[model samples]
Target chain A: MDEIKEIMLDILEEMTGEPMVKEDLDLNLLEEGLLDSLDYVTLQLEIEDRFGVLLPPSEYTKEELDTPRRIIDVIADKMAV
Target chain B: MSVRFYDGFEFFVLAAILSAPAIWLGVTERRIRGYGIFASIVVILFVLKDSPKSILLLAAYLAYELLLVRLLLYLRSRGKAGKGIGRLVIALALLPLILSKLAEQLNIGGFAILGLSYMTFKSVQVIIEIGDGIISDVDTADYVYFNLFFPTILCGPIDRSRRFSADADSVMPKSEYLQLLGDAMTRFMTGVLYKFVFANLLALAGTDRPYIYGVYMFFDFAGYSLMAIGLGNIWGIKTPDNFNKPWLSVDMRDFWNRWHITLSTWLRDFVFSRLLRSCMRAKLLGGDRVYQACMCLMANMLVMGVWHGLSANYIAYGLYHGVLLALTELYQKKSGFYKRHKNETAYKAVSWFITMNLVMLGFEIFAGHII
Candidate 1:
C-alpha cells in the first residue's frame, strides 16, 4: 500500500512538474485542477509501467479516482483482485 | 420559427417566464425540484419551435434510449457487461443520432430531434458508466432529467452522469445558492454582450474574410455556451464552461483545452482515451506511444468533424484539424528545439500566433465558406 501511494505521488509529481507532499493526497486531484481527464489516462499508463498493474480503462470515472487516496485504493483493489 | 438568441424579445420573454419561478425556488426553498418541469417545458418549447410533429418522433427516440438503458441494466444484473455487449449498447444508443445525421445527408426529413446529438452523447455516457459499474443504479426520473437538462440540451458542455448526479441529488445551501446566482447573472450578461453586441457586429461586417468569420464564430458560439452555463446556474445545476481564452492557446492541444472545452474533453474521454487504451492493451504499433497517439487523435478529430455534418467539407474540416493536432503532438514530443525553447517567452508568442491562426482556419472551415 505504501509502495502504491509513493508510485501514485511520483506520477502526480511528474505530471504536475512539482514535488508533491502528503497533504496533496487528501486534495481532490480533479477539482484542485492538478489533473484532467486526459492526464488521468497518462497517469494510468505511468502506474502500469511502474507497478505492472493497469487499472481497467473506461471502467472508472475520474471521480472514482479523484484523490490520491482513491487512486491508491483503486490500484490496491486491482492488485488484490 | 426557431428562436436562437436571448437578445430577442420573444426569447427574453420566454426566459423571464421560465427563470422567474426557478429563481424563486433558488432564493426561497434553496431546493429546486423543478428540474423535471423545466426540462419538460424546454422539450415542449423545442418541439413547438421546430415542428409539432417533432414531439412524437422525440418521444419514440427517448423511449428507445430508456429501453436501451433498461436492457443494459438487465445485462449487468445477468453479468453480461462484457466488451461485446458494451459496444452493442453504445452503438444502439448512438443509432438514432447517426440515423438522423444520415437522413439529413440524404435530404430526408422528419426523423430528427432538436437536441438529439447531445442527448445521444449523454445516453452513451450513462450506458458506458453503468457497464463500468460506476453508476450502479438507474433512477428513471434522474435519467430523464439528465437527458433533458434543457439549458445544455441544445448545445452542450456535456455534463457527466456522476458529476451531474451529485448536483441533481442535492440542494445547495443558501450561501452557495447566492454565490451561484451571482455567477449566473454575470455569465448571462457577458453572453448577451458577446452574442448580441459583438458577434452580430462582426457578422454584419461580412464573412468574406476568413479571420473575421472566425472571430465572429467564437463570440457567437462562446456566447451561447456562456448563457447555457449561466442559465444552468440559475437552475442550480453547475454547467461547465465551454470556452476558456481559446485564442490565447499556444498549440492545437492547448486550443482544444481552451475552446469548446467540454466537447473536446468528451471526445478525449469517450473516443481518444478509449482508442488509446485499447491500442495499448492490444499492443498496437508495438506499444509506440507516438504512433498510437497520432492514430487516436486522427480518429477522435475525424469523428468530431463528422458529428457536425456528413458533408465532404465537414470531413475535410475534421481531417485538417486531425492532422494539425497529430503534428502538434509529434513536434511537442520529438523536436529537441521545441523541448529547449518551448518555455521561452518569444518562442511561446510565435507558437501562440501559429496556433491561433490555425484555429481560426478551423473556424473558417466550420463556417462552410472556405473549402
Candidate 2:
C-alpha cells in the first residue's frame, strides 16, 4: 500500500510540477487545485508504464482519480488481473 | 437585387417558418423514421444547390476514408509497426493537407471546396491517435459522420475525426436526447446573440475605436464556436470549447488557451510538442526548463503560422506570438515570479490582458492584409 501510494504521488508531482507533502497527500489533490482531468490521464498512463501492466484507459474515471486509496487499489487490482 | 440577410425581421420569419407544423414534424416525431430520409435529402440538396462537383467530392471523401481505415487494418493484421512507421503514417495523413493548403495558396489547382481545412486536420488527428494506439476500433459510419457533420462543414471548429468518433460511440440514453435538444437550442440562441448582436455591433461601430475593434474578433470567432457546439449538441455530439474569454486574457499563452482553443490544443498536441521533442532529441536545445520552454514557444509559433495558412502575415503573427512566449519565459526565469504566485486567478487575469492585446494586434495585421 505504501509502495502504491508512493508511486501515485510521484506520478502526480511529475505531471503537475507541484510537490506534495507527506501530510498534504490525499484525495484533496483533485479538489485542492493541483491536478486536473488531463493530468489524470497522464497519471493513468504513467502507472501502466511503471507497473508493466495493462490498465485499459476507459476504466480510470475522473471520480476514481480523486483519491489515493482508490487509485492504488485500482493499480493493485489491474496488476493482479 | 440587394441581398438581405436574416436580421430581426428575417430571424422572426425564420423562427416562425421553422416552428410551423409542416417543417420539423417529420424530424421530431412519428415521422422520426424520416431521420435518414431527411439526411439523405440534405446530401442530395447540397449536391444540387452547390455543384455537380459535390457528388465527386462526396465520393472522394468516402474513398479517402475507406482507404485510410482499410490500410490501417492491413498493416496491423500483419504485425506491430515495423521501423519508423509512425513518421510514415504522419506523412501519409499530412500529404493531402499539405497539397490542399499549398493549392489554396498557390491557386494552381482547383479548390477542394469540401471543407478541406477542417477535414484534413480531422483525418490527421485521427490517424495520429490511432498510430499512438489511443484508438483501435472504429467503423465506416463513424468515419463518415466525423467529416460530413453538416453544421460544421461550412464553418468549422475543426473538430477532429477520431475524437468525434470516440465520443459518438459511447452509450447514450434516450433521456439525454431531449436534454441535448434543449441545450442545443439555448446554446444556438446564445450564438445568435454573439454573432448578430455583439460582433455585428462592434464591427458596425467602426475599427477606429481600438477597444471595440479588439473585442470584435472575440465576438466573431467565439460566436462561431458557440454555433458549432450547439450543432454538435443537437447531434448528441460535443466538441471542445474553442474560446474561453480570450479577450480578457493578458498574456500570449493565456490568449492561446482562450482563443481558437481547439486549434491551439490540436497544434500543441500534434505539432508544437512533436517539434519541441524532436529539437530536444537533436541536442539543438538545452535540457533545462527555461530552454525547453523557449523551444516549445518557438516550435508552437512556427506551427501556428502554418496552421493559419501559409501566408506572410500569418507567419508574422506566429513569430510575434513566439517572441511574446519567449519573452515571458525569460521573465519567469529571471524573476521566478511564476513560482511564487499563489493566486493563479490574479496571475492569469494580468496575463490575460497582455495576451489578448497581442492576439488582437495579430488580428489587426490580418485585417490589414485583407484591406
Candidate 3:
C-alpha cells in the first residue's frame, strides 16, 4: 500500500511537473487544473502500465478519480480484485 | 392540433391533472412505478395524437430499438458478443436518427419524429453499455418508460437506463419523496422565471448581438431542462442536471463542464474517451499525445455539430469550438508562461474574459450570424 501511494504520487508529480506533498493528496486535481482531460488519459494509461489495472473510463467517472488519494485507493481496490 | 410538451400553461396544467394519481401515490409512500408508466403512456399518446405520422414513426422506432437491444442481450448471454457485431448493432441503433437528420437537411418531411434525437441518445447509451457488459439485462417496460417519460420526451437531461430504472423500481419513503417534491417545486418555479420571464424578455428586447443571443440560449435551454428535471423528480426519477454555473467558466473546457452538461458528458464518455483509448492503444500519431488529443476533440465536436444538423452553420459552430478547445489544450500543455502564471487571480480573470468572447463567437456561428 505504501509503495502504491509513493508510485501514484510520483506519477502525479511527473504529470503536473510540480512536487506533491502528502497534504496535496486530498486536493481536487481536476478542479485545481492540475489535470485536464488529456492528462487524465495519460494517467489512466500510466496506471495500467505500472499497476496492470484497467479503469474503464465509462465505468469510473472523473469524480471517482479526482484526487490523488482517490486515484490511489481506486488503483488499490482494482489491484486487490 | 399537436400538443407539445411544456409548450404553454395549458400543457402544464393538463400534465398536472393527469399526474395527480401518480403524485398521490408518491406522497403516500406507495410504489408509483406502475402509475408512472401508465401516466407516461397516456401523456405520450395525448401529445402525439394529432400527428398520426409522428405516432406511427415513434412506435416503429421504439420497437426497432427494443428488438436490437434484446438481440444484443441474447448475444451477450450466449457469449457470442464480439467487437464486429457490437459495432454493427450500434450503427443499426443509430440508423433512424441518422436518416432523420439527413432528411431534415435535405428539407424532406415525415422522416423526423418528436424527440427522436433525445430518444436515440438513451437507446444508444443502453446498447453501448450492454456491449461493454456493464448492462446485461434490460426490462422492456423500464426501457419504454425511460425513452418516453413525457417530461423529458421533447428535450432531455438524458437519463441513463440503469439510473432511471433504479429510481423507477424503488418506492421512496414519504419523507424522502416530500423532500424531492420540495426541490422539484423550486426547480420548476425557477424554470418558469427563466423561460417565461427572462427568456421572453430577452427575445422581445432583441438578440441581435452575439453575446445577448448566447445568454438568451442559456436561459431558454436551461429553463426547459430545469422544468424537466423538476417534473422527473416528482415522478421519482432523479434526472441529472443540464447546467451548472456556466457563465463563470474560465475556459472552453470548463464551459463544457458547466453548460449543457449531460450532452457534453455523454459525448465525452461515449465518443471522446473511446476515440482516445483506441488511438492511445494503437500509439497513433507516433504517440504525439497533444496532436492525438486535438484530433479527438475535433472529431468529437464535429459529431456534436452534425448531431445538431448537417447544415454548414452548425458544422462551422462545432469546428470553431473544437479549434478553441484544442488551442486551449495546446497552450496549457505547452506554454511556459501559462505554467508560471496560471494560478494567479489576474490571469484567471483575463482567461475568463477571453473564453467568454470565444464562446459568444461560437454561438454566433451556431445562430448563422458569423458564418
The positional error of residue B224 in candidate 3, measured at the CA in angstroms, is: 0.7
TM-score of chain B of 2: 0.81
Model 3 ranges off by over 4 Å = A1-10, A17-25, A50-53, A73-81
lDDT of 3 by residue, B113-198 (tens): 77999999999999999998778889899899889888888889887788889999999999999999999999998998898889
Docking class of 3: medium
Evaluated on the second chain alone, the candidates' TM-scores are: 0.95, 0.81, 0.98
Against the reference, the lDDT scores of all candidates come to 0.80, 0.63, 0.87
> Candidate 2: where are CA atoms >4 Å away?
A1-4, A14-49, A52-81, B1-48, B160-163, B166-174, B207-210, B276-284, B341-352, B369-371
The runs of at least 3 residues in candidate 1 whose Cα sits more than 4 Å from the true structure, single-residue gaps closed, are A9-39, A45-81, B1-7, B35-39, B46-50
Best model per lDDT = 3
- Clash count for candidate 2 is 9
Cα lDDT tens digits, model 2, B1-371, are 11112234543343344334322432343222123224533543433454667557655765775677667656766776653675686677667768877887897765465666677777777676666565666677777667666556545777766556655655455565567668778877888799879998998898656667767877877777787677566555677677887656655655677778777767766765555545544556454545665767776787777767787777777777778777876675567677687258887776666666666677776555433
Residue B151 miss distance in model 2 (angstroms): 1.6
Measured by TM-score, how close is model 2 to the native structure? Answer: 0.78
TM-score for each of the candidates: 0.89, 0.78, 0.94
Better of 1 and 3 by lDDT: 3
lDDT per residue (tens digit) for residues A1-81 in model 3: 999999999889889776753568888887676787778778878998999886656666788888898999988888887
